[model samples]
Target: MTIRAAHFTPEVLLEAPRRSEATPNSKGSLALFSVSTYSFSEHKRQSELRVLDISRNESKLVTDSEDASNPKFLDDNLITVLESKDGATNVLIGDVNDFKKTNYTAGTIDGSVDDWKIKDVGKGKYLIAIAASTQPDGTLYNSEKAKKPVTTGRIYNSTFVRHWDTWVTANKNSIWVGTLSKDSKTSKFALGHFENKLKDSGLESPIPPFGGAGDFDITDTNLAFVAKDPKLNPAFNTKQNLYVIKLDNGSSPKKIDIPGFEGATSNPNFSPDGKKLAFLSMVQNGYEADKNQIFLLDVEQSDPPKGLFTTPDNKGTWDRSPSSITWSNDQKNLYVTAEENARVKLFSIPLAANSTNSSFPKAVFDEGSVASTTFLDSGLFISSSSLIDNSAYHLVPSSGAPKLLSSSSRSGSSFGLSRSQVSEIHFPGAKPGTTIQAWLIKPSFFDDSKKYPLAYLVHGGPQGAWEDSWSTRWNPAVFAEQGYVVVTPNPTGSTGFGQELTDAIGGEWGGLPYQDLVNGFDYVEKNLSYVDTDRAVALGASYGGYMMNWIQGNDLGRKFKALVTHDGVFSIPGQLGTEEIYFPNREFGGPFWENKDAWNKWDPAQKTENWATPHLIIHSEKDFRLTIAEGLAAFNVLQEKGVESQFLTFPDENHWVLKPENSLLWHTVVLDFINRKVGLKAYSEQSETAKALKESALSG
Candidate 1:
């Protein structure tokens, strides 16, 4: 199949097949993945399951039903998938060659399941674990008829009244454990009664909003999971603890304690033998962005399995924070993904028991951001993406270079884009001897003699760095296609660089990081002759949104012709509406009252006298993280001050515009706003932007 060359616009990006992380089968000879794409002609999204043959480098459709998802290998030739049956989730078993040809029900659950796992114990019995919502009585909670008060009013005596977009209720996201056995009479797998692992513990496993299968892991006889501490206030604490329980016995969970560590713990990984457990740990309390260190535990499979704490024998302290952990096939080494120099790279760490000579992890794969990885007998299966590429699967052998297996796009030429169009620039930072990196994307049709307007995008997580990855939201390629020189800087506080740089932004919201961005913009304007800063427009969301407001009130505001802030903070003192109070508490040294001076110093509301730029304010009604009030307040100030500004609100969206239709609208309006301010054609009006840009390209 060939994809026609076209402009990488929002509509095109939305329509592009969104692929999930590919899971390799037990033999590693085949992989399973699902793809979802929005169909403009059908006016709905379509989903399908596909099987990829590793050796042949070919793919075949397994099922095209929208209800089919989460395909996994029950064995080499058999596969297990979950499908919706009468509003409840049920597992189905089928042959890999033709799933529907021999499909049959393997097990059924009473309610909706977010994630499910199966581990073969022995004989005909298997351990089944699922993460789902449960009521106070430890019963599966059905979301369709979720228990809610009849009254319209909501009362809250405790904090966490709401998280992200949903209000806190009696129902908790918990893990359920059960047994599945095969009956010789019918030769069918039957699901036994499931018991809530967190029952009466007052804790939620796989914490809401983002947690899924990664929150917990199960072995044949034991289970491990991460849960927020019940003793602390959920609103202002980041103290998620690790717990382990026996799967065969009705036993209570045992919390693993780290004497000096008070921060959060996550990503519990058990060795192949299930005797050693590894998890990532942060040392600082309330600070969620701290460097994560790998902590090992020795598990003795006694009656109640005793867990003894163990630490890595270090030659030195590592600076990078690992996002995920995976044990080696031999359990002699560990592979992890961590950010380094604006890229998520794979690192290998040698594991030794009670040894004090283990060196730091070494980088194995250093190109592109690795989204997910699976262990293979011959090598590692990596799914990664970059600025010009949507998704690509590669097999990195232990001794050789990575071999590309498949890519979401047929080729770069098929999309009218190439890796050459993207480059990185490093400039001097605000502090002496410091440097910052940024990604620079040129238009598809580029001429070295012609200058293009600048689109400066600041990333949200103040701690988050601009990675060399593809994103449907805030895509630099989309902006570059609009005839702009897009430069995204990784200023101070950006992650993947080092812990020092990441922790530098605390209490200095508008200080060194702002200067780093200013210096980056300055470098682009003065050093890059093809970029025209005179018609530049800056945009950001979340903390990046906050930076736009900060720039609006500082000297940097005069550098850009226009600014866009999405769910940004207008006033530090007016942030009580946010559900995560711990964010400000750690960033500002304490709560508002305790650190009034520090909060006031960086408050954009205090410098409203300097507001004089054309701005676009985008906020969502359900943005409980920064709250909608913050956006409204910024717009009000801009309006009252006679600044040229427009307000765009999505009543149905949360912090992000996720719905396909809503995302398209967001991109359209954002492009229109920036284009209009920079004297470029509107997105809807110019359907030939790609062709025009292509014609302007320099000869290869």
Candidate 2:
């Protein structure tokens, strides 16, 4: 069976530019943002800087290059941006008036800068904090030479052999401070010799692979950054601690001794007065996603840091995880963004006299999911969006409705669907008095009397929720474009509902969450006449993938015509050894040996005899979180049981398909598999390009 390929073409759904990394100037009159444009034909990403005038609501292009990001306002007239050129990344300082550019890392070899801070001191002296990657000897690690070993067949002496998506290299991130000196000839500023702050202690700033500007902060006399010691167990002991280095007098960095909270500390921010430091701390060791609370430390006093406002229960739960903290000019209030009831809202908390006990976070912006926010003299400038809307900038006042400043219309319009097409649906769960929220996205060309095929997508994080936020991956609009009525539900294990609902799936991954999904499907089928339940397909990744595996083994296998599992766990006991050991152990109650019954209760490997559903198994080799072994085992079971299935593997990808070309291939394969299994052949014709792609996929 074949369908017209025009509806599923990449050009129809892939032309949106991504906007991020918004930074407002001191006066808040103008803001700079990075906009990324993708070219599917070329398979490349090009980034450009857009300067938005807050008052006028106008944007002007600043720089257009492949490596332009992290734009910061050094001063009212000076702007700094990171640019990559000739296979090296460097800091570029530009004047706002004339846009004259100057390369700060001119003499440095193959240098790269990640996060940097510029602070003005007295008498033309400036303290600059830079999170830069260089070799152990303060030189650039030549990529061409690093690819080849210095000595053939050298002995290995590294702890982290590889991480996330890249192999661990000798290039490590270090914090450096450089003084600005004006060149007499050109009247442009250049950094005078940079001093390595982390020279005495061999540690990397922002830890590696994941940390960013949130992991560090800077003041006039001191710089506080997050780093993990390589000597510790790299696998299970990835705890980042806060270390403060004095800018002057050459003092070694000192680890801040915060009593009772010794796990991971990040998002360091200094108060306006610089007397106190505010940061986020997680209490449990080895568990990265443990509940994080805001902590305040008095720089002058040696007392332990005070635990400020936390969730209502005061326990390390999943209720609140505050991030993107910003301090008010008066130092009396701190603003943060946290997940609440299926959306991320901006919240503000007052700092009391004692600093120990503070008021609960008051919701500042409650409408949409805020991704990034910046403070201005007029109001708060935020980038927010709903499930049906694309990311846009809004100016939110102290007490008024948020005004839209700029919208990402390029991608939003590319979907060819209006906001009215997507609506929220709530249904009662299997458990009494419990309500499950699901988003129903109707196809653009919909009729009330017509029945449409259903696409049920499950979100990954057992603690994750299908919030009213836009997603580039697993987009409901894409599924809707393929003539499927998409339904995404936030079940019992999902966050953003409440602590009780999220905690209900801690030890019962296959229990309440599974029932909530089934009940959700049943509700849609029974109540919604437009949904064709008999022609439904279920797809999921991570925990959702685990549920797919569970459903295939359980009685729910007969409900859906086909299933798609991406990087899902098949055997709990087998995954216990290969997967990341910390969170799974806690979520499954205990070790597999100690809690064998709990581990095997929902183990899909134990019920392979009941697996009859046709499935599409997807896995990546670098997915260290779930590992490729899980996908292989599930595929092996399906083959042995003679159930129709196909296995797709990406040798270069990680837990998520990130590369542009890889993502295109993933979507193509997934859509083709679903269409073939669900017998979707309305057009009964195929384009030559579509046939060529199908043949290529099969031949490869």
Candidate 3:
């Protein structure tokens, strides 16, 4: 007898293995990566470090410890990784071949380490650069500060009183460079002393919240980093400048000047010879979604170190914004990844002098979305994923086609997923000349003869798009497997199509983008016969959440059976509650005081009379970006309007629900909400435990 596998569910999506980007050796013959999986049965997560042999396309386990992370290649045979020791981050050095047998603790620092980089200068001498939080007194900052100076109130005179999820404090993230003297007798390394790179500058390198080692680069003689301009107010400014300092001399940091470019800088990379630097920059001062242009700097070794900054001559012709930048091993070309249409593709830009204005970036790899790339002597090492696939690795050689190195799930049997169930489509946009792209997903056991409810998902960022990518949160697959024909539409403000489309939503937030969503819904109703529009539901987060509120007030609100919004805006004037004040300013053309009509034109709070749809509102208390008040206001309105509504709050989470247990509960509640409203219960085959929870949710 043959027993079929269970359909794809929230459990399958969350428990599947998550793989990190692969780090290649100097020769590019071997790569190191990690895989982590959560076990519901054990209520824990297990991680393993693996080494991949490129020649044979095989991988072997190196370690399975959960403590190890941020692995980097020190040499062809050596590696350095971060591990937790005595409640502090410690560096461990070991051979890649036999890590357990030859590993030893290299050094431990005082504070929490977010990222670290190591360079072997020569002959028993090395430099270790650690990116950690540093206090004004030059000591590393850690969790100890949480318990000391127990002040019940926090005082602030600046606009950035809070950001993202943390309260603004005196501590800033800076790079600490220290010398590691190797003991020749025992072959062990000891850390001597440390120096704060941005001591008194009142600046931070590797900007707060999400910056890491990529924000700075180090070579044998000099260090280059990007820091937010200290003069600008962080709450309303999006400017990050570049600086270089001499490692051998006690010289002050020199700001690298890019005359016309003044927006933001990221991913500083030094050439192999350490004579030139390459990075990505944006041109606008306040816009965070500006095009990322590639820039280069040439350094002359002289007193005060003369530096020349220049952008690519073809920058004016390159329409796509590069998300990441990397120099080829030979320094003749640069590799970058950018979103085109609806896919993130890797392209090669030649640096030859003969390159003409017609020289556009040539796409080398366009299979799935390229998450990250590691430039290698052979070619490029890529980590990518798609709507059905979770993780895959490929090597695009210098001359030949790309070769598949490894895949997280090679077959649908692994998690009951199939590429056939995923598809893409295009339809007429809100305007005549524009077109909208959407990804349509069907259930694993889809029956075309049966009608399925429509799951309409709007993406955040307004500048963001729904790509041919896989995600654990708000996964279209999870919705599809539960008897829905999920449709994710990229409307007017969605990126990847071009800059024009992405910029169209500014100041017209609730105008054209909302029309595009209505057009998309209408298209599905008339075109996709398998979808039951009468049983449709809409959901989104951030800008998408804002759209849900917008839809609730507009004529589109009557078409949906239910709506789910996470961390969304309730009123346009409510922008004052956001931490990134500049975001609303750039989008609406100015602050509410300066642009009264524009701010109130699309206010959802003013259109509360039409709010009759059932809504599920989810918001985190720590999400300073949108703040908890926005969610509370929306829920209050829904309740006062006599609408079916439920508010779910996570005090420990931020804008996103990242904790494993919380994510499970989130998915369970969300699925139950939509399913009950759509006149279906998709989890009938679940165990008694899940049924009890679903019943409890219904009762509540």
Q: Pick the candidate with the highest lDDT.
A: 1
lDDT of each: 0.84, 0.75, 0.83
Error at 509, model 1, angstroms: 0.5
Q: lDDT per residue, candidate 1, 36-58, as tens digits?
A: 88965566988899999989888
Error of 3 at 343 (Å): 1.4
Pairwise TM-score winner, candidates 2 and 3: 3
Query: Which whole-number lDDT from 0 to 100 does residue 556 have in model 2?
Result: 79
Runs with alpha carbons beyond 4 Å of true place in candidate 1: 145-148, 301-316, 353-357, 687-700
Query: In model 2, which residue pairs have backbone atoms overlapping below 3 Å?
Result: none
Return the clash pairs for model 1, or none. Answer: 445-693
> What is the lDDT ranking, best to worst?
1, 3, 2
Best model number under TM-score: 1
- Tens-digit lDDT track for model 2 on 1-700? 0122234334333446667746778787777887776776566778778788877877777878667767777777577677766655566777654453543442332556677787777555566777777677865544544556576443447444556666666678887777765566765666667777887487788677877777778888788888875466555564778887777779988888666665778888888677788898876666665567888888777777777754444564336877668887778888888877778899888877765556778888876589887776677888887765556788788778878776665324544556767788898875688899988888778898999889999988888877767766667777787788899999987776765676677788888888988889889889899999999999999999998999999887788889999999888887654534656676777777898888888888888889999999999998877878999999999999999898888898888987666666677778877877667742213334334444565742
RMSD of 1: 4.7
Q: Give one digit per residue, the lDDT tens place, for model 3 in 1-700.
A: 0122476788777888888878889898899999888876777998989888878878888777788888888779787778865547777888899998888888777777888777778897878788988877867886754447766687887778888999988888999888877798987777768788778877798898888888998888888899999999989999999888888887767887776677888888887778878788877888888877776677654322121222444234567777887778787877889999888999887776533222468999998799988888777989998888888889998898899887776634566788899888788888679999999999988998889999999999979998877788878888998889999999998888888888889988899899999999999999989889999999999999999999999899999999999999899888898888999999988878989898888888888899999999999999999988999999999998889999888889999998776777788778878898898784533534345545554534
Would you list the clashing residue pairs of candidate 3? none
TM-scores of the candidates are 0.95, 0.90, 0.94
